[model samples]
Target: MFPTSRIPLMGGLSKMSSSLMANVVHTPSILNSRSTYILERARPLPRIYPRQRKRPYMNRSTYVYKVVQQPYDRLMRQQDLQVILVQYVEGLGKAGDIVTVNPNYAYNNLLLPKLAIYASPENLANASLYKKSAEEEAYSSKTSKTLMRLLPYHTIPVVLNQDNEWTIEPWHIKASARKVGIHVLNEASIQIPGPPIRGPDQSLHGKDFIAIFKVNNKETIKMRCKIFIWATKPAERNSIENQFWCFKGEPVHPEEKDDLDLLPIEQFNPDKIIIPSGDLENTIVCAS
Candidate 1:
């Protein structure tokens, strides 16, 4: 009775244990109810974040070039060449028939020194008679002035290969088209604008006029040409197709006609034609 005021600590511990047991028994239903409420209110993840899909990469397109070939069956007509020489002739005799001048005549005489042959006496007599009957006109005088102007030789004709890789030098003038492998139509001297002494030092070379032909079973060919010539003048770059003739022998002036035929250097096509650039000193190509 005298110590009754102090309640035992054992009683408090027992009470706390009882309360915890009650909470454990009732807590299951409470937790189930909370879970139901959460299920109703919860939201799903964003659509973008669900699954990552890779985008396909794109590629650039390419283009191709096409080359067209012509039909081999296409035919070209060829005609025989008839040489017409118009020169200051003393007369036409058996001995005066077309004579070829020696190439050395130019050096010997100034321009051309070579002499193929001299006019015979009989030819001289005929020439004298013809001269007497016809009106005395100067040899330099233009005969058939209108027709002479129309002559093909007055303008040179040149054909260019595909790709325009090859071009004639002395590129100032343009060439007219003439029958292949034939006499120059108009045979007039090219007119130089300035004095004779002040002409261009660099004319197209005889060797630059390249000719291609087929040979024998050995697949041989010939080219009568020299190496390519570069332009000394800047303006000449566009003038590559100028008409110029290359002969085997010395070139004849419009006033002189002493050649029966012109010799040409010929070569096989594709196999023999070549163009090299930039100090090509050691490249010596021989063609037959």
Candidate 2:
């Protein structure tokens, strides 16, 4: 015969014990050899990695280098420029003359204006022919000598008709000679003793001056001419005495003292005096 209370107590103890064993079986053991083997066999927990730094992005198309090439012939043409004149260019040469000039100058001033052509053999030949012809027709020494002889004896008169004060220039002397059947082509051929004649010191009126001419650029061939300024219309005066003031190496007159005082010291030469005759005495002469 089982006791009724002892039966219930035994049932409850069995239930509790079963629950405790289940819990013990589920828990991991630190000291157990089986647990240690399983842990060694399993893959290590996925390594926790610090976040990686992002790299900066760049577009390769944004950076680019380009090189430009110039043609070789274009550079060469600018350095070496040769041209020939089809027509006469003063200070350069006569027609058909070959010359070297800047490319821009040749194109704009010569080629564009049809004044010159490119240097060629045919143009050179023509230039040579022209030079030969010009030399043959050039003024001869005999003619130049004859002109030179006449220059010393003759006087060229320049008349300044303008009422206002005017300065005497080399051109004026040339023009005066031209009027008197003498042609002076080159300005350098005429030589003045002093600077260009200007007022109120050196006037263009009522004065007798001398100019030297270099005949045909020859050192030995020189001519001296008397240049007289006729402030008023020239009168009929054959002798130099009538045309100009005559001072025969005499003392300055009381009336002329005022004029002499007014004259520049450089112009007043005490030793020199204007003679009444055709011969110029004690005159200062300069030659170039």
Candidate 3:
């Protein structure tokens, strides 16, 4: 027969289990914030990726090169040099006067032009012959006043330098003036306002630019000098007129009377497109 105690214990367990299961409402566990956070922290984190930029599309065979050119520093970088002047340099000294300057300036502006000699023992010995130029006499002469009035009206022709470069230097300008019968005794006196002219600018074939004549570094005269390009073939390009038409008694080109683009208008081709004085709207409508 089954044991009476075992049977009672089994019946009690069944009653307790049935009661616990009957009409039971299941609910989620209430947790403290720290514990909840810990549970959330235990979960595997989602992966994050960095923002990527797409490279520009190009052909695999394509190549690009960045060209870097040296910066231009007026070429005034040489050490100070002592030079004996053989002619008058306005800011510096007169003939036979020894002065110190940038070696670049001394070479390019003075020594090369035969305006000054290097102060070697041989040169110093012959320095006695380097008499001061009669600059006062030259300037005070009767023709100087006329020259001042006429210089601005004259066209200054520039040429391709010995180096085959188009960059016009002060010495180049001085030589050009000498060739054209204009006497510019000193390169130091020729002052261009901006970065040196590098041309024959096709569009600006005949143009006037301002030049400052610093006389004795005391008086400054602003003159409008016309720039003319000199080339081997005259037939290739039109020659710029040697003089402007503004001065009274100067002949004006009747053909260029209507042109306002280039001054001294005489140098350029005449404006041939004459606009008929009829209504422009009607003309355009008719053409359309």
Candidate 4:
């Protein structure tokens, strides 16, 4: 058939072809294995999220403050005063007398200047002693004794004006007594039988009314007084009783004259007397 040299050449070519086919198959398998190993070794990327910002919380019951304004002049004028005293001040009073004064004036003019001091217990006791001495001196005087004796004999005349009805108060008696050189210190010393004496009644007017005076609540002195109520014009003298002329020889009215002395004791009538209803038991009528 074929030639021996050509056969050997074909055999070498076939061997080369087979070797190349083997290399091509092995390369595809190696590439597939590498891709799988890389995929298994790698890790996934971490998740990313936006950050949230926080807000402050508000409360409902918070307190709010309001300021009030006042005027400067008004504040200055509202200064509170304090009470203090020391030695006698000309316009104020005697030593140990207590007084009220402005705080600023007291501190600056009195305390700091050494013009005065606070009224303490010791100073007040001294003042009481002085008051007692003055009272004792006044009681021992001649004027005081004369006033005491005169209370029994004196007849205080309370003249009623155009208004025939007059209210006789204890002070009215005191003021009337003062006009006649008598000084009544305590109003409680004078005693009236009824409520205040109110009258135009003929039984009370121009009649002897009794007033009791209790001196120091010990001695009881009886005073006989007359209340004269006459019209603006002169009236008949016979309209009044004989006792109206007891104090003076003549009547209060110029047209009238003293016609009689006090009535006789036997002729005294309890019905005609104007004594207080309460004093009916103690009252006694005596002719002078």
Question: What stretches of model 2 exceed 4 Å from their correct place?
Answer: 1-140, 200-206, 220-288
Cα error of candidate 4 at position 284, Å: 26
Query: Which candidate number has the best lDDT?
Result: 3
Residue pairs in steric clash, candidate 4? Answer: none
User: Which candidate number has the best TM-score?
Assistant: 3
Model 1 scores a C-alpha lDDT of 0.29
Query: Backbone collision count in every prediction?
Result: 19, 0, 0, 0
2 versus 3: better lDDT goes to: 3
**Model 1 regions more than 4 Å off:** 1-198, 201-230, 233-252, 255-260, 278-288
lDDT of 3 by residue, 1-288 (tens): 323332222212344544444443322121111111111232333443466465545443334333332222233223588888886665566667778888888899999999888988888888877764465433433234554554554444444422234765678767655655667777799886665667545544445455567655445555544454445554554432313222222112233223322333223224433232332222222211
lDDT of 1 by residue, 1-288 (tens): 223224332212444444444433333233312221111213333345336675433223212223232222122112222111223333321211343343343234322322222344554445433332123433322233322333322222232332234433322222322223223233232232211211122343322232222211112122222223445444443232211222232232322222213322232344433442322221221110
Worst 10 residues of 4 by lDDT: 32-41
Using all chains and alpha carbons, the TM-scores for the candidates as numbered come to 0.17, 0.30, 0.32, 0.31
Clashing pairs in 3: none
**Clash count, candidate 2:** 0
lDDT tens readout by residue for model 4, 145-196 = 4545545555565555434567777777787666555667899988855455
TM-score sort, best first? 3, 4, 2, 1
**Candidate 4 lDDT (Cα, 0 to 1):** 0.48
Error of 2 at 121 (Å): 35
Put the candidates in lDDT order, highest first: 3, 2, 4, 1
